[model samples]
Target chain A: MEAFKETLLSSFIVFENQLNGQKKSELHKLRQKAFEAFEKYGFPTRKDEDWKYTNLKPIIKHDYKIFHPKEQKLQLDEARKYFLSETDTYRIVFVDGYYASWLSLTTHHQYDICTFSALINRYPEIADEYVGKLINHGDSFTALNTAFAREGAYIFVPDNKIVDKPIEILHFTTPHALPAFQQPRSLLVLGKNSRATVIERHISLSANPVFTNSATEVFLHTGAILDHYKIQTDHYEASLIDNTVYQLQGYSVLNLTTASLGGKFVRNNPIVKLIESMAEAHLWGLTKIDSSELADHHTSIEHIAPHCQSNELYKGIFGGRSTGIFNGKVYVAPHAQKTNAFQQNNNIVLSDKATVNTKPQLEIFANDVKCSHGCTVGQMDENAMFYLRQRGIAADKARALLLLAFAGEIVDKIQLPELRQYVKRIFNQKNHIDFDFDL
Target chain B: MLKIKNLHVSVDDTPILKGISLEIKKGEIHAIMGPNGSGKSTLSNVIAGKEDYQITQGTIEFEGKDLLELSAEERAHLGIFLSFQYPVEIPGVSVTNFIKTAINENRKAKGLEPMPAKELLKLIRERMELLNMDKSFLSRSLNEGFSGGEKKRNEIFQLSMLQPKLAILDETDSGLDIDALRIVAKGVNTLRTPENAFLIITHYQRLLEYIVPDFVHVLYNGKIVKTGSKDLALALEEKGYDWIKEEVAI
Candidate 1:
């Protein structure tokens, strides 16, 4: 713990050395304050209820060095497959903890679609106000990310402006100089009455023990609509801690989904705050684990406004000795009456050694509201398996088909056509099986 | 060409079938009628290689192959089909994809390549038409949200698609209305040929009117007590199994 703190405190020097005098002056105070919070909380242990299933000691114990966005040149041929090449969009690509200009396509259109490091330089006030506002800093990782929140994507949709094309933020970890500890923070502040879609992915080129602490803060103004997706396909040697927070104003709608197929240990914390009436939020996730992998999803929706609604669904499939966890909470403030909230977490343990822990919590002080939550854990239906086999489907293929179908409950909800297909396609490609059903 | 001699089956150490013998030849349709708990469905499951039923003393030969040695899927690959009394519902798996996978797997087991998509589509459309099913039903999830009649009809549709050598219809007439029963029987009749055979296990004789059988056997107390012509089904349907029980008592 002391080593991680000392290393974190020392990285400020390395981070500031790369910046100019003007840029360093703007962010110096905020970094120090954020670092103080990180030092206070240190690393959460198993005794902490939130981190019960996930252990961060293995990741934080490394004698890590601060990562700088280097000038490494990677061929487009190598990194193109990680992208959704069929779709055109404003793409901001980061490689080895550095922004790769040759591989990125940022926009200068009516609304900004660029990098976060650039936002801190170009517009420091907006960056400072919106950066740490919604980030719940009690968590040690969130504080750590805020202390070195120099790298990530910056997405802004101006009021009344509709960006027809989706924005793609692709972060590729190459393990360039050493085992990299990267904190990439993205801030998405959508203007009033605007709508857009954002797709984020973490692709690893080499498996050399990379740990990424990523935080994305989205501010949805009145009547804004955003369809957000995060696809994590890192190698087994890499670990990812993803924290995304969304604050919705009146009459706004936010839909977010996380699809995790790779990474040895993955933890996703998606928090949504509904602050005004008629606002709705849907938080969904799907995790499929095999071998000794582990994936934990923590989701919470805060209803601070009246007549708001929130729904959460998370599903997982575990095999081998893998483990999974889903903890969802829906909180309605006392004044937030008539808030309808629902949550569900379902899982299938295909092996005896696999385990899953699911908890759905709802705290409503309102008198005239409807809230419900359900959870179930079971194995593949033996009757269904036999029925498929009686029709001559091979056992292995039958299992794959049933699993893909089971996952379809969540995959089908993906709105983007290419993104939906890519999610299914990548899962099949990773399993080295063909689940080519016409779903 | 199938033979089940001295077949004794037990599930969870409790005997369900005791000393049952039957022979089915090519081009023959044999119907087995019995009362509740008469082990009619047990016979179909045993023949289909369901693992839960322990075959204590029996030998089932299908076209001179030791059928007991094969798995359920292998039994399917060896041209054995069982139209389940109750079809399983699978969500997100379309009927088209399910059947395509089943047919391709069967072909692969026989060392054949997957059927061409065009050919498979043509075959599916023809079978669906024969079953009097709408084309839209092909896109739906397999048996998910389907009514009992629709589920039974789908069983027949799959029977027509797979076209196995020996087909076993286990209680296929239980949940069907009169109209669905006639259509399903008609599909079965249409698919029947001199080279393939059928073992129809039913509780009522109403289905025998649409599907004329060469013989009807009365299974009582886990044994075939009576084997006679199709007239026996009509007589049993009229007189009920009580008369058979009384005669066996005598």
Candidate 2:
């Protein structure tokens, strides 16, 4: 851990030197402050309560290359497969932490969809308003990502406008031979009475390990609506740490869903703050992992205002000695009366060696709020299996069907039909089931 | 076409079926009436190849083959079907898809081609109409959120679709209302043929009134103590199983 810290410290100095004389800018000042914070509180270990189930030692031990000098390009045909092939979307793609303008279809008309660096150069005022407002400064991973954030996605929807097309933010790591480390930063803002949809993913093209630490901040103004989905189906050698925070105003709606299907090690931190009355947030996650993979989701929802509502449902299917963790915390302020919050975590452990650990923490200071949570971890239903088998489905096919049904509850909630089919295809591929039967 | 000789079964080392013997020919409908916990379910479950029960001494032959050697699904592939009393709810799998998978899997096991999509759709629509089920019901998850009557009706609907040679109704009349019971009985009566047999397991004689049976056997304490015609079912319904228990004690 110390060796990795020293390496990152030296890399930060070189990263700062390449900033090109923007030292006096507010954004750069924040970067410096974030760097100091990262330096002070290095990587978190298993000793930390939040990181109790996730060990970052194995992920950070590799001497990963932090900078890429040469510009990497992907063929249109090669990159087209990763895009939503069935629907038209505003794409902002990055290759090796560098924006691929030629591969992107961004716009600056009614909506602003571009890279973070482009946002800083063009709309610095907007960047200053929402860039680091909701980030947790005490966390080393978010601080490290902020210190080196430059070329990820920047999406802004102005007031009273509903964008017709969905926005896709894609990061593809094209590592040649050495291990690569990337820090991708994204910011999404929906103005008052506005609406938008965003899809974000991180992919590694090769078998080499690519470690990604990412941070994203979302702001939904009064009467605004935002639907966000994160797809974490990267290579098995890749490890990802994602920190996202959503801040909601009065009457705002935020629907955020994350599907973690692959990756060797994954840790997701999604925090929601209902800052005004009548705000609503729905957080959903589905994780399906096998082998020795580890997927940890630590979510927190803070009901700071009255009459706010939140619903969280996270489900996981573990196989082949995999490990899963779901730690959810809900905090209701004293003044937050009539706060309706419900949370549930359900997991299915497929193999005898697989494991699932789920914990739900609720702190309700207000007496009038309705808060409830439940967690369940068990194997597949034997009665359901027998039912299907008695109907003539083979044992293996029956098992696969049951597992798919267990996951269908979450997948069915995806608003986009094409995206739902894409997720189903990916799930079937991962589980080696031929889902040719007409849905 | 089915025979069970001197069958003795146990679950968790405790005897459930002490000794039972029964025989049925093709085109015959045999009704097994017994009180609760009299091993009625154990008989149906054992015949369906449920792994929870152990057969201490038995020989079950179907179409002159050793039925005990086959798995539940293998038995299904060999033309056996069990209509569950409490049909398991499988969320997310629509009724159409579940039936399609079941039919295709049975075909695959028997070295036959899958039914074409058009043919399957037509067949499903026809069967749905026969069962008095609406089109929307086909899209709902298999038995999920369905009413008690709908589950039993769906079980009968599956029987009509699979067209199995030996169909075991495991307390299929437990939760059905009169209308659902009539529809289910109608489905069974329509599917009966000279090449197939039916074993209806129930606690009441109401279902037999609709679909009259050729044989009514009183199963008491894991053994079939009395075998008679459909009149036996009405007699037991009038006197209750206490008369059967008293006769057995004698």
- lDDT by residue (B1-250, candidate 2, tens digit) is 7899999999999999988999989999999999999999999989888887889998999889899998889989889999998899988899999999999999999899999999999999988888899899889999999998899899988999999999999888888888888888888888889989999999999999998999999899989999999999999899999988888899
Model 1 segments more than 4 A misplaced = A13-27
Estimate every model's Cα lDDT from 0 to 1.
0.87, 0.90
Model 2, runs deviating above 4 Å: A437-439
Q: Worst ten-residue run, lDDT, model 1 chain A?
A: A22-31
Error of 2 at A345 (Å): 1.1
Clashing pairs in 2: none
Give a tens-digit lDDT track for model 2, residues A1-439. Answer: 7887888899988988888866777889898999999999999988998988887888989888888765756876788889985248999999999999777899998989998998888888888888999998899999999898887899889999998899989998875688888999999889999999899999899688899999999999999999899999987899999999999999999998899999999999999999999999998899999998999999999999999999999999999989999999999999999999999999999999998999998999999988999999998898998899999998888888988898888888789887888888888777888877635
lDDT of 1 by residue, B102-178 (tens): 99999999999999999999999899888899998989999999999999999999999999999999999998999
DockQ of predictions, in order shown: 0.79, 0.80
CAPRI accuracy category, model 1: medium
Chain B TM-score for the candidates in order: 0.99, 0.98
